[model samples]
Target: MRCHKLVAYSVSAAAMVTLVAAGDAWEIKSQNKLVKHCANREGYDVCNIVLDISDTHALCSVCRLNRTIPDLAKPENRLRWSKLEQAKRRLLIGLMDLHLPLEAPVRGYSRGLCFDFLEDQRSNSDVAQKFITTGHRDGVITINILEADDVQRVWQREHVGERYRTLLGHMRHEVGHYYFELIVSDREGFGQIFGDVDTAYEKALKNYYARGPLPGWEQSHISAYASAHPAEDWAECFAHYLHMADTLETATAHRLIEQFSEQGDFEQLLLLWDRFSASLNEVNRSLGLSDAYPFVITPIVKNKLRFIHSAIARYVGLQL
Candidate 1:
């Protein structure tokens, strides 16, 4: 997996982590006798801890390859890093749930998904730098640590006018980029559906960034970010599909939604998704919020999502 070139460091020396079980909490076993606990936020799972308190930010199995960590010496920064870590774990869990292939291009090339959580000068008043980039590449995903701060995230959210924004959302979006490589680079049937992805991705991306998206992009693209590149378009759509499917599955599991056809085939899933999404939008309106799944399904996009479903089914050897 190709790694990002940038690195993160703390403004102050590291502080030892201390563990305590305050009450009913989710915990996971670590290499040592110590137990790591979940931060207990929505969309997070227990398996995502980077270290037990006794270990003082020691890397967990999943966090071991991290070349750097954002400096957390500032009192406020420490709280931000903790929140970011939880969100990162939740995002990773969602990817694992999708059963996408993982592994670095050169190292665990066979299978493994990896990430780098970083902080740049933009977020730390003590740091001398002025900018940070947030995106994904190769096998590794890099997130600017500033995103962990609510004020920064909220500012960006409003500036972008995005309906939904969360750490998990960013993770999902980046994973969309990763799967582009997995499905577009290797899957034969996928090429037929998504088109010849070999069409000079770099040139297309440059054009997208320079000229801006095509007019009437809202008619098809799920988000403005999708307009940045074809691969980004694919990733944004893929992430939206997962968001819909997973949330709908949870609703069905809890009897909030009727069970989808037992065949659970892709077509059946679409049928269920459509009805559920409509209801979801209605519920959001009741709360004075925007639609939960906010995009129309053109026949073209439907075909693309079907290809995504089909590819996943084949990888898991599930009949569809």
Candidate 2:
């Protein structure tokens, strides 16, 4: 995951027209014999399956959120964009399953979302003259195209000392920041639960990089990066909450576990997650890969996740 520095800016009103037109191209259509079947590319068939089932002439809802895709004139950019879209669809599907809102800012919803898949000089110097960092601002999330490359992502993981990192993880983490603005920033007692987000962000970030996390930071923070700022702590915890929710949902869908209700008791969800994550790790080991989830959830972290669940339940009108 890249460093997230919140920038204050609203979506341009003028862009709404173009975004709406793009979204309309993906509307579900009745299957008909006249419809031309789309071909799946490189075994990445989520978008193709969506088109096939719906008989739509455009990409899926998740793919339609792409306001800006990387330049496809470059051969490698197409594959990278494809990989990014796959991870993005997974995130969107999970959000939908959880009954969270999926409106785009262009759709007249204040909390609407969009994506900008960009590349920096590191990936294509001829096309990108400036650096591109992954972050979320207003309603738009930006992801660096290099993250889609397995070799580049692995190098970043080692350089950052992260036990696990993936393009999906990046999306989940950045969206956490966006939701904090929508769900928590204005709520009463927000500071009390997640600390003060109104603190000087740039200075805090500078200091965090200068001296690193405080001693025994893991006792309270979910990750070393989370200790950098209160906002980061909330985002990291929120990301972890999504990790658990989506993975549990996938496991249930695959019948690896009996059907379980996410809207049920929060404690029960955590218990199931404890068992499921352990099994997931064992499965990864059997395949000679690292643990699927590499961080321990201390008691404090659990409390943070519960807070997230409560917030999400509130947003979705659930009793959990």
Candidate with top lDDT is 2
For model 1, residues 192-252, the per-residue Cα lDDT tens digits are 6554556787787778767777687676567776666556777777887777666765787
**Least accurate stretch of 10 residues (summed lDDT) in model 1?**
6-15
RMSD of each: 9.7, 9.7
Residue 224 in candidate 2, Cα distance off native in Å: 0.9
Candidate 2 clash figure, as a count? 0
By TM-score, the best candidate is 2
* Root mean square deviation (Cα) for candidate 1: 9.7
| Candidate 2 local distance difference test against the native | 0.73
In model 1, what are the clashing residue pairs, if there are any?
Answer: 1-104, 1-105, 1-106, 9-71, 10-71, 17-56, 102-112, 103-112
